[model samples]
Target: MPIQQKDPSRASTYSWPGVLAIALGALSLVVTEFLPVGLLPGICRDLGVAEGTAGLAVTATAILGFIAAPVTAIAIGRADRKRVLLGLTALLIISSVLSWKAESFATLLIARVILGIGVGGFWAISITAAAKLVPPEKVHAASSIVFAGISIGSVIAVPAGSYIGAHADWRDGFMGASVLAVVCFALQLVFLPSLKMKHGVNVRDFFGLLKDPKVRAIFLTVIFIVAGQYAGYTFVTPYLEQITHLSTAIVSVLLFAYGVATVVGNFVGGAFAGRNLHNTVVATVWIFVLSLASIAAFATSPMFAGLSLLVWAVSWGMAPVGTQLWLYNATLHAPEAAQAMNTSVFQLSIGLGSLAGGIAVNHAGLHSSMWLGALILALAVMMVYIVGRMNRQPAVAA
Candidate 1:
C-alpha cells in the first residue's frame, strides 16, 4: 500500500513514497536491533544457560550500541544519508544470516555486536535523513512517522520471534528479520528522495553540542529513566513467578498488558510533550514513581497488582518518547547530535541498570530492587525539573 501525502510541499520532490519508505526503513533496523530480546528464551533453552545469561545477548547489543552509535554518527554525518541507511540495512541482513547459523552462545553474542553497529548507525542517520527529505514544517511529523517504525517493529518482532521459537526454529526468527531488512533496503533504493544535509561536520562540532547544560541534562534524564526502569524490568518475570505467585500463562498476560500499555504511553507521551515538554516529563516521572511503588506494595494482589502494572506500563511508554523529545528540543539546530546523545544515554542506562539490578537482586531481593528503581526515577524527575527551571525553559526537559 502506498503512503498518501497531504501537503503540497510533499510533491514528487519528497513524495509519500520517499517518506513511507524511510519509515519502514526505520522499522526494519529497530527490529534487527531488538531481535535478541525476542530470541532470549529460545537461546537460553538451546545453550543450556540461565535466562539472565541469555539476557547478556541483549546486553551485548546495548554495550556495543552505545559505543558504535556515536562514532558511526560522526563518520557518516557528512555522507549521503540515503546511502548510509542503505548500507546499514545491508549489514542488518547479514546479521540475520549469521544469527541463523550460530553454533554457540559466543557466536550469537558476536553476531549481536555486529547487529548493534548496524542498529546504532541506522538510527544515527534515519531521522535526520528523513527530516531532510521533507519540508521544514513537516520535519517533526516525518520524524515521528520514522520513529513509529521502531515502535511498530518492537511490538511485532518479539511476538514474531516467540511464535517462531514455539513452532519453527529460532534460526527462522532471525532469518525473518533479515528478510524484512532486504525489503526495507529495496524500498529505500526505489523511493528515497535525495536531499541536502548540513555539512562540514567535524568531531569538534559534534562535541560542542555536549557542552550545553540543557543537552547534558536531557541526556542524564534519559540515562536515569531508562536505567531505573529496566533495572526492575530485567528481573520482573522471575519476581512475578517467585513473589507474585503467577503461573507462566498469567505472567505472559501481565507482560502483554505492560507491552500494550507501553505502546499507548509512547504516543500519549509524545502528544503531551509536544504541548509542554516540562510538565509532561514531571507528570510522567512522578506517575512512574507512584506506579512502581504501588506495584511493589501490592505485588501479591492480582487485581491491584494488575492495575499497578498498567500504570507502570504507561510510564514505560512515556519515558522513551519524553526523553527523545527533550533531547531534540535541547539540540535545536543540531538534532542529529540530540539523536546520537540519546542513543548513548539509553544504552548506558541499560548497562548500568542491569548491572545495578543484578547487585540489588543478589543483595536485597527482587522486591527491594523495585524500590531502588522508584528512587532513581524520582531523582531523574528532580534533575530534569531543576535543570528546566535553571535554563528558564520551564519545561524543556520536564
Candidate 2:
C-alpha cells in the first residue's frame, strides 16, 4: 500500500506521522549530542587524557552548536527543508562513525564538532517544521511530541550508553548511537515532505525579532529558567554523593528515575500549555523553584533528596514545551528565527548555569548551588507572569 500524499498548501488536517518523524529526529539529535557525557571517564582513560581535558568533547559540541544554530538557519535560506534535514542527519551519521573510531582526544573532539552542526541545524528547524505539519490547534501538542525527545534522550539514551560502556567497551556506545542515527535519518528522508524555507532569518531580521517586546521577554525568561536548571542540575550527582550520602549505584538509579519522571512531565506540560499557556508556564517555574528550595533546605536525607529531585525533573521537563509554545505563538511569522534564538539561548544557559554552579561549589558549598538556582527560578517565575500578561496575542487555544 502506498502512503497518500497531502497537499502542503492544504495542511489543515494534522499529520501525526510527520510530527512523530520530527520527534524521532529530535530524539536522535539529543541522544547523539549528550552521548559523550556518559562515556567521558572511559574516553579519558582510553585516550590518556585527564577527566577535565576529556570534558572538552562535550564543550566542543555546545560551543559549535551555540554558533551553528542561527548560522545554519540563515545559510540554508529558501532551501528545501526536508533535504536540509536529511543532509544534517547524514552529518550525524558521519560524526557518529568517526566518534566510534576516534583514536585520540583530537579525533573525538573533531567528531563532536561535526555532531554539533547537526544538532544546531536540526533543532533550529524542527519546531517550526513540526508546526507546519500539524493543525494550528495541535501545534503545541506536536511541539511537545518533538521536545519529548529531549527528555527521552536524557532519561533513556544517555544512561543506556553509560550502561553499555560499563558492560562493554565505551567505543561500542558510539557505534550503537551511530546505528540509531542511521535509522532516524532514514525515517526523516522517507516521511518529511518537501518544505521550502519561508522568510529565512538573516542578521538584520534576527535582531529585529529581538526588538519585539514579546520576543525579548520570552528570551529573558528562558535565560533565567534554563540557567537555574543547569546551575543545580549540572552538579546534581556530586550533591547527591556528598550531601545525600548516596552510593554511586544508588545515585545512578536515582538519576535514571529522574529521567523517567522528566518524560512524563514533558507531556503533562505540553497538554497544560495547550490549554492555558501562560498559567501552565507560570506554574512550572514555581514548581521548579520549590524543588530547588527543597534540595537546598533538606537534602540531608537521601529519601528527601530523592523526592525533591523527582519534582525537579518533572517540573523542569515542562519548560521546553512551555517556552517553545510561547515563542511559536509570539513570533508567529518567524518560527525558525524564534526557535534558532531559543536553541542558542539554551546552549548559553547551560554554560552559564554550569559556570555559576562551579563558582558556588568552590566558594560556598554544594547546597549553595541549589539556593542560587532557586533564586534564578524565582526570577523566571516573575518574568513568566509578566510576559504571559503582556503578550496579548490571540491565544493559540481558548
Candidate 3:
C-alpha cells in the first residue's frame, strides 16, 4: 500500500530545539557505541582478557544492533515516537552505568548488547524523523546536523575516551558516556514533541524494500563502500607507525584533522546530495577509492600518508547523509524500513571490514589492507554505476 500524499501547505515549520536535541542524542548514541574502541587495551588488562577478546566489546554492540534495528522498528509500530526515543535514551544511561560497573568481559558484553538496542532504535528514528522536525526546505540541513553527530563522535568522543581512560581508568569512559546520556535524555524529555505514529511499518513493508532492485543496489553500495573503508581504516594507525614511521602525537593530530575534514565533508555532502544524490555518491566513491589507492601505492612518506588519510576521511564522512538520502528517496514509502536496513547493513559492514582487515594484517601485512580496501571500493564504484543504470523506474512511495 502506498503512503497517502500530504498537502504541501501543511508542512512542518523548522523546530531548531527539537532537531538539535535529536542531533545531540545521535552524537551521544554514537559516542556510547564506539567508546570502547579507544580503550580496548585498557579493557583487556583490567578485565584479564586477550586484546582480541576485549575487541568483542565493540563487536557485541554492532552485531546486536544489526538485529535490534528492524525488530525495534516493527515492534514499536504505531507507538509514540517521542516516548520511544526517550525510552531508548534511558536504556543508554543504564547501559553506561552497567558498563562502568562491569567486572567481567561477559558482564561488559551484556551491557553493550543493551546499548546496541538503544543505538539501533535511536538511529532508526532520528534519521527518519529529521524531515518531520523541520520544514521541507530545511530537511537536508536537519539531516546533516543529525549525521554531523556521527562525524563528531568519530572525531572527538573516542579520542576523549582514550585520554580519560588512560588518565584515570577504563571505567571512567563509561561513566562519562553515562553522564552525557543523562543530559541528552533529560533534554529530549523536556523539549521533544509528542511525535505519534502517522503510519506503522509492518512485516510486509520491511520485506517489500528488498523487492526493489534499486534498494538492493543501494544496500550493496553501502556494504561495499563502508566495509572497504573500514577494512583499511581499522589498521590505519599501525600502517602510519610502520609505513610512515609517524609518532603517536603526529598520528593523533592526523586523525583529528581527518575528523574535522569529515565534518566539512558532511556539509558538503549534504549540499551535493541534496542537489544530485547520484552524482554525489558517484563522486564520493571514486574519491574514496583513489584515496585508498594513494595510500597503498605512495604512502612511503608521512606527508603522503597523512594527506591520503585526510581525503579518505572527508569522502567517507560525507557518505552517511548521501547514502541515507539516496535510500530515503529510493523508497519513499518505506523510509524507516530503508533506514533500519541501512543501519543494520552499516553495522555489519564495519564488522566485516574489520574482520577482513585483521585477516589481511595477519597474512599479508599492514599495508596490504589498503590494497584490499581499494579493490573492494573499486567494486563499489562499479556497483553504483550498475545501480544507476537499473534505476530507470521512477521511485514509488510506499
Candidate 4:
C-alpha cells in the first residue's frame, strides 16, 4: 500500500532542530562507520592482522547494515519514529564504547556489527523523517541537510582519526565518536517530535518495489557506484603512503581537503538533482570514472593525485543525493520501503566493494583496485543513461 500523504498545510512548519538532530545522528554514525578506513594501519598493527584483513572492520559494518536496513524498516511499522531514532542513537554510543575497549580484532568487529545495525536503520528512516520535518516543497533541502552530515562526518573522521592515531592512539578516535553520539542522542531527545507512521510497511512492499524498472536501475547504479567508490577509497591511505610516499601529516591534510570537497558537492548535487536528476547523475558518474582513473594514472604525482581526489570527492558528495532523489521520485508511493532497499543495496555495495578491493589489494596491488573501481564506475554511467531513457518522466521539483 502507498504511504498516505500528509496534509501539505500541516507540513509547512519546519522543524530545524529536529532535522539538525537527525543530521547529527548521521554524523556520528558516519564517523564510526569510516573510522577504520583511516586507522587501518594502527588497527592492523595492534591486532596483528594484515591491511586487507583489517579492512574487514568496514566490511563488518556494511554487511550488517545491509541486513539491518530493511529489517528495521519492516519491524518498526507504526512505531514512533522519534523513539526509534533515539534508540538507534543509543546503539551508536554503545558500539563506540565497545570499539574503544576492544582488545582483539574479534571484539572490534563485534562492535562494528552493532554500529552497522544503527547505521542501516538510521539511514533507512532518516530521509523520510526529514521529509516530514518540512513542507513538501522543501523536502529535497531537508534531505540534503542530512547528507551534509555524512560529508561533514567524512571530513572529520579520516583526518581526525589520522591525527589522533599519530599523536595519541586509534582507540581514542572511537572514544571521541562515542562522545559525539552522546551529544546527538541528547539533541534528538529534546527536539525530535513524535512521528507516527500512517501506514505500516511490510516485506511485500519491499519486494513490490523491485518490479519497477526505474527502481531496479537506480539500485543497480548504486551498487556499481558505491562498490566502485569504496573499492578504491578503502585503501586510499595506503595508496598515499606507499604510492605517493607521503607522510602522515600530508595524507591527513589531503583527506581533509577531500572531505571539504564532498561537503561542497553535496549541496551542489542537491541543487542540480532537483532540476535534472538524469543529467546530474550522469555527470557525477562520469566524474567518478575520470577521477578514479586519474588517481591511478597519476599515482606518482602528488599534485595530480590530490586534484583528482578533490574532484572525486565532489562527485562522491553528489552521488548519494542524486541517486537517492532518483529513487524517491521513482517510488513515491512506497517511499519508506524503497528507501530501505536503497539503504540495503547501498551498504551491500559498500561491503562488496571493500571486499573486492581487499581481494585485489591482497593479490594484485593497490593501483589495481583503482583501475577496477574506474571500470565499474564506467558501467554505472551506462546504467544511469539507460535508466534515463527508460523513464522519461518530468523532473520532480524540490
Best by lDDT: 4
| TM-score computed on alpha carbons, candidate 2 | 0.81
Which candidate would rank higher by lDDT, 2 or 4? Answer: 4
- Cα lDDT, model 4, residue 72: 97
What are the models' TM-scores? 0.85, 0.81, 0.85, 0.91
lDDT of 4: 0.88
Point out where model 1 deviates above 4 Å: 1-12, 159-169, 194-200, 235-249, 274-276, 358-372, 393-398
Per-candidate clash tally = 3, 0, 3, 0
lDDT of 3 at 15: 64
Candidate 2 versus truth, CA RMSD in Å, comes to: 5.0
Count of backbone collisions in candidate 1: 3
In model 3, state the lDDT of residue 114.
94
Judge candidate 4 at residue 214 and give its lDDT. 80
Put down candidate 1 lDDT per residue, 245-282, tens digits, no spaces: 87656765666667778899998998998898778878
In terms of TM-score, which candidate is strongest? 4
For model 3 the TM-score comes to: 0.85
- Computed on alpha carbons, the lDDT of every model, listed in order, comes to 0.73, 0.79, 0.79, 0.88
lDDT of 2 by residue, 47-116 (tens): 9975445545656677677778899988988787778888988998999999999998899989988988
Tens-place lDDT per residue, model 4, 120-142, is: 99999988887888777888888
Provide the lowest-lDDT 10-residue window in model 1. 6-15
